[model samples]
Target: MKWDYLLFYRWLALNMVGFAILWVFHMNGMVEPVFLADSSYIVYVIAGLFLYGMVLCGFRVWKTSRELNWVKRGDKGKLKEFADKSRQSDRESVKEAFEIKLFARISFVKYISSSLVMLGLLGTVIGFIMVLTNIPANAVGDAAQVGKLVGALTNGMGVALYTTLVGAITNLWLNANYNMLRTGVVNLIAAILESADPQ
Candidate 1:
């Protein structure tokens, strides 16, 4: 039986890397690109998705860790009590299992991660349009307008890329940890059940 501690360490390292990137961006004043309509939406959407994912992952980790600790106590009687409690109602059991498998499934992460990238692409397209619309037509103040438009475009692109990176990295780390924790949970439960059964 492979231990989950090592995998958890790897997950922590990856999470730290994601945080470091975000900190750097924040320190550089790139956290929220100066409020352009298109650019702002892109950042807001991606941040929302990643934040939701983080919360979901955190819940999975907390519940599984608590169960794993109990199982590791090697108290067969306690294990049987837990299993009985877990099956209190068919509907509740089904809901719990669904939550576990949902977190464990890598596809969930992929979908959100891809969505972040698409959001970035969409931002890029809008940013391009904004810049093109500002093209100078030999007007006296046209050059200044062009510069502002170009700056907005750059900011939009930057937010798009950074958000995508953060989302992907977070999803990857969470998925890896989910699998490791899930395996540990299943193993511990099985052992407890077997020991609790009367010979």
Candidate 2:
């Protein structure tokens, strides 16, 4: 029933660092810069990174759980006994795992989602600014110039709306998947331990 304490800690550390970085980006005003930019591609890149980080967290959790000592032992009788105890221990550990709790805590999602929403709003604002500044000067100024400026604003608005949509969808997706996967892993470990216990 021995546990690999190091694996648990390492898993936790990685998750914490990832979430921390995500939070930092949000607090630092990612939305402002992305919105005011001349283009929307940078916003896409940032959003992609954020999504990747969430997926990475999930993989780390699953991999760490798989590497536990109890799970690796092959002797049925002994493995069961050990796995049962290890399951109990891991259950306790996972219960207290802050990294898991972070998924539940709205702070992480809120910060990330809010940043995304803000980024969208910023895009919208910039788009509005462009529209206002590019009025035709000639009987129609350069129709092309005004049209181009207006077009930029429309693009910005699209970016803003899409970013916010993505942020919201991702927050829900990440939280739901993480909970389901984590719960399933813990429950399976518990079952293995129970079945392995000597009757």
Question: What tens digits encode model 2's per-residue C-alpha lDDT throughout 1-199?
Answer: 5554444455466557656875797799864654455365535754674576465645645553553444455434333544555566765554345334433442343355445555555655655555555544552556557667566556656555655555554555455545544554454455455555558
| Number of the predicted model whose lDDT against the real structure is largest | 1
- Candidate 1 has an lDDT of 0.57
Q: Which lDDT tens digits does candidate 1 get at residues 138-158?
A: 433676566665665566555
Root-mean-square deviation of candidate 1: 6.4
> RMSD per prediction, one decimal?
6.4, 10.6
Off by over 4 Å in 1: 1-21, 28-38, 74-114, 128-163, 166-170, 173-199
lDDT of each: 0.57, 0.53
